[model samples]
Target: MKHCRTRLLTACLGLSALTAPAFAQQACAPRYPPPTTIAAMFDMAAVTADTLDALPDVDVVLAARGGQDLSKYGLRHSHLAFLVRNDQGSWDVVHLLNRCKTDHSDLYREGLVNLVGESSITTDLRVGVPTPAVRGALKALLAGAAPQARALHEPRYSMLAYPGSTEYQNSNQWILEVTAAAMAQSGDGTVLDDRKRTLDWLKQRGYTPSRMHIGIGKRLGARFFADNVAVTDHPASERISGNYSVVTVESVFDFLHRSGALERELSIPHQTPVPAVTGTASPRQASSP
Candidate 1:
């Protein structure tokens, strides 16, 4: 009777021990919070951008010391400039202007998609040989091919522009003149040589030379805008306006390729690794140290 009682007790203990972890896990397992809505995401980006803009210029520099905080402000305007992951495990942007909204869906298709009509910086250069891996990844994105682990070897591109006005004409002309001067200073031979190459490239692509415009915007304050609106026949024009630090697409690709974001994106697998179980004794450890 004593032996049977002891065995029964031992069995009960074992059963409890076996079931405890399952129970504990059920109690402790994380309940993922509700997914953020598209509107909420856009609001966050706007707040972030506004806060960034409001900070002292020096403070902005400090906050962005090594990474994207600075770049984000420079590259993005009211549009959803940064990327966020959704509950369904996809990356998306929340464009504030409803630029990406379509009748078919409220949530825009995310990841490696392109702006309608024009090729992004990555797609435009991918067909050429001796292309960098980052460039290839960007190309893959523009082509809707796949996400790459590597950073793209290309400068970022944006289609946004300030509203047009003839009042800012002088400011616009100044922007072009500055661009030409910079191109002249940076070229291997003469500014004319580089201009010829650029013009030829544009011509080969069937771009109308007369439609090219370079100008500064009064609305943008001191910034300059360079655009190729004629190529696409867009009435508002496609322009990029910023300080001299901003490089042309060719320069941007060369720099990004050298920086290794492209290679990293390509080589790294998408799935993050599950952490190894820590502090648990293995079967062998249960027997000995």
Candidate 2:
């Protein structure tokens, strides 16, 4: 769901391809969010924090945001991450972020506020509380067994990476793989050693990916112009038809729900301030000590 399409398809492919590299080496320009937007985002972050704080029985949960307009796909949230309860009792976000305009990605650990930064489309936050056993395992995986957790990420990134392939990975795909590995951990401490095993574990659990139908025109455009979208890693049969079984936030959430991995789901709405009356104090001022 990382928007890495910095360059659009120009008039002449030959000239543009030759002059401009396939990928942009530098990160995309920072967006200057309006003050009001920033305030709203902070408000959403605060509400999200409060919601997570209320989940006393959960140590790790899935957090998602509406980063993109995915209504066409019947999806709400466009990105997903794990919120692990830190020693300080605050939650921290762990997720994969693709290097801007590149076919590469890296794991990032940030605070809840950063995860909800500059809200797009919507400021509503989705949280999935895992079953107690699953939560404990995930907490252990991301904390005590962090190296093993980090090893699960495949650096090569693709927007529509196949759910069953290790050639490339999308952000949500990484979470699925890691969750498989976490679930595969045995009481004896044995764990799935690699991505292949994790994928197999997911298959055994009946994990289903979201099937997206990309038209030929859009497929061609992505293939030729987008570095973060690839078809080579996908099954030829599926690729040729322009339908891809890719991992998405909704797909992963459905899988977890079906597998009895998630015990609860909730959405925290963005708390916007009420309009101030002509001579009244703002909400912030009224709430102040």
Candidate 3:
């Protein structure tokens, strides 16, 4: 069984879409139109695809996209996805995206080219490859991702969601929790299927998530109006002492690194060019990673 916890809706709070009023939802809708020129679109897609193609021998991979200016809060990559080769022998980038006009997010399967094209910001990307020890389990998790993802998923989205609490989840939090399912070990190396149990294991093992220092006005306004903004899932001690939780791709990378699951890190350069072709298809080989 899943242990879910949630609190009252808050107002707008996003570095990407922050700085808005209580009813900012109407004003804060994010939109990304298609690139103006075909050449511009090809450049973004080719660079993103080439980056993935460069990772030889990597089967299961974690990737992040930084299209926003999150540097003020010490964030580089704002979004994350798992890259795995699909059965068709082509790589795919799989992740959760919040469905616009709704509070829920569902799994999205995108090619490396589309992944780049979907970016609302710049085309820079980051990738993390796990050690061989964790790769097998990651494969299993990917194979069963749909059912498992749906069962534990909550439609509520919060950028500063509490990791330990089941109340809400951000994009990175979902990745972290799914990783927990892969790394959860009993006496031996078996993983825990129950999400609650996996979470318990993570806490016992000292998996620390990033905590953002939010001020009074931004924090209060977000908590009052936006359903996607939350504060109650955080610990009472943190609230009193003022340590708020915000899950980022960096936090998940840190947790995996601390747990010794990460083997290598790669920084993909957007300036690098790929041979531009009329077709948008990425060569099919294995999967998204």
The top-ranked prediction according to TM-score is 2
For model 2, give the RMSD to the true fold.
11.2
What clash pairs does model 2 have? none
Please provide, for model 1 over 103-139, each residue's C-alpha lDDT reduced to its tens digit, 9 standing for 90 to 100: 1111123221211111121111121111233232222
Error of 2 at 232 (Å): 0.6
lDDT of 2 by residue, 1-289 (tens): 1111111111122113223322122245556566566555555655566667667787788888877677898887888988877676656677887866698887766656556765522567888888887787888888853777777788899989998888998989888877777666733355975788788888977999999999999999998999999979888989889888989998898898887788889988855644434687889999999
- My TM-score estimates for the predictions, one after another, are 0.19, 0.81, 0.73
Each prediction's RMSD over C-alphas, in Å, is 22.7, 11.2, 13.5
The alpha-carbon lDDT assigned to residue 127 of candidate 3 equals 81
Q: Which residue runs does candidate 2 get wrong by more than 4 Å? A: 1-29, 120-123, 186-190, 271-289
Off by over 4 Å in 1: 1-85, 94-245, 264-289
